[model samples]
Target: MHRYANPSRFIRIADTIFPWAGGIMITAFAIGLYLALLKSPADYQQSEMVRIMYIHVPAAWMALFTYAFMALSSAAVLIWKHPIALLSAKAAAPIGASFTVICLATGSLWGKPMWGTWWVWDARLTSVLILLFLYLGYIALINAFDETERGGKAASLLALVGAVNLPIIKYSVDWWNTLHQPASVFRLDGPAIHPDMLWPLIIMAIAFKMFLLTTLVTRIKSELIAARVQNVQRSLHGNLADGRG
Candidate 1:
């Protein structure tokens, strides 16, 4: 892990993994969509509308998962001051924000038919909203300082602080009387969802994960290139100053 902190090494590693990730991402999405739309039976209660879960539930899962990843990366930044850690946390923000948006939008679409409302202030919903805000806030804070290191430090602290919302989001349905349902896929006993519905959902979740990994690696590579360019400029400037002196 530490060996790949150097941007060049990381880029090579990313290049190696990206092709496989891309192939898997495409395959998963196609198969998952077919299963989700054509093969899976409609919910007895929600009917065809239940198909929204194929998108909504996974988006919600990614929203929480991304935040948790950011928090861990932020911790790595603070403890080890690794450039990859900082870049990874920064790279993950927009992706997480996009997932949060999808979750909220799909949830609203699902809710309208199921709950007779477009939105509600339920515990899970509210906590997930806070997670979205935290992502935006971290992005803003990271870019606020002109000094990159300072900005990273500030954003890292904010990420660590914001991690509290993750658990709240996870257990919101359990802890409160909420519009959201409790866990179905993961539980003490086993999955509540039938294997028929579960397979497509799992496949879609894998697709989402693969997509995120590919995008994050690309973003980190971009950041590394920008940083390299900045360093070259600084070195050139220093050489010119020495020559003049």
Candidate 2:
């Protein structure tokens, strides 16, 4: 991992992976959407409305997964002082937040017909909302300071501290009486969902993962290039000031 601390090396690796990630993401989305929308049978109870789960569940899972990834990156930044760690965490924040927003919106759309309400203060919903706020807060904090390093350090601390919410979000239905259903897709016994539904969900989840990887790499590369340019400008200005003096 320390070998990747060099931005140039990291970008080289990312460049190699980017096209593969994009291709896989596109293919998986095509197949997953076909299975989800056209092939899978509608729910006996919810009917066509269950289709929303195809998008909502995957987004929710990615939201959690992205945050976990970001938190680990932030930890690397703090503990190992890995040069690319902060960039990875920073790049991941908005993506995670966007997933969180999609999850909330699609969940609300699903809930309206089933729960007779678009919004609820359920344990699961509330915890997920908090997760969104944490993402936003982290993004804001990281840009709040003029010194990027200082801001990143502060935001990394917040990311680490906010990790406590992950478990709460996962087990909210189990820990409390919430309108949200308990785990059906992931169980100690096995997934309770039928294979027909499960396969599409899993494939969609893969597509989401690929999307994250592709976007994260792109964002990290941009950050590295911008930082290099800024450094060059600073050095040029400093040399000019020295000549004048």
Candidate 3:
């Protein structure tokens, strides 16, 4: 893991993995969508509206999963000073934020038909909302300083501190009487969901995870290229300065 901290090495590894991840992501999404839309039985209660779960639940999972990854990357950057860790965390923020937004939006769409409201101030909803804010805060902190290193350090610290919310988001449904349902996929004994619905949900979750990996790798590669260009310009400027001096 640390060996790949070097930008050159990281890029080499990412290049190797990117195409495979993209291909798997596309294939998984196609199969998952087919299963979700065509095969899964409609809920007896919510009927066709329950189909939203295929998107909403996965986005919600990714929202929390992305933040957890960011926090871990931030810790790596701060503690080990891994060169690419901060960049990886930075690259993941917008992607996570987008997932959070999708979760919220789709939830609202699902809610309108099921709950008779588009929005609610439930504990689970609020906690996930906070997760979205944390993502935006990280992005802002990372770009706040003129010195890129300073900005990265500050943002990394913020991410580490904000990690407290991840657990809260996870247990919110368990802790309170909320509009959100309890865990159906993961339980102490086994999954509560019927296998027919469960299979599509699992497939969709895999597709979303793969999609995130593909996007994160692309974003990090772009950042690495931009950083390399900046370094080259700085070197040229320094050489010109020394020549004149």
Q: Pick the candidate with the highest lDDT.
A: 2
The candidate, 2 or 3, that scores higher on lDDT is 2
Give the alpha-carbon lDDT of every model.
Answer: 0.92, 0.94, 0.92
Report model 1's TM-score to 2 decimal places: 0.96
lDDT of 1 by residue, 1-245 (tens): 68879888899988988999999999999999999999999999888997899989889889889889999999999999988899899999999999999999999988888899999999999998899999999999998986667899999999999999998998899999998999999899999998889999999999999988999889888888888898999999999999999
Clashing pairs in 1: none
lDDT of 2 by residue, 1-245 (tens): 87778888888999999999999999999999999999999998899898899999999999999999999999998998787899899999999999999999999999989999999999999999999999999999999987679898899999999999999999998999999999898789999898989999999999999999999999999999988999999999999999999
**How many clashing residue pairs, candidate 3?**
0
Cα-based TM-score, every candidate: 0.96, 0.98, 0.97
Best by TM-score: 2
Residue 239, model 3, lDDT: 100
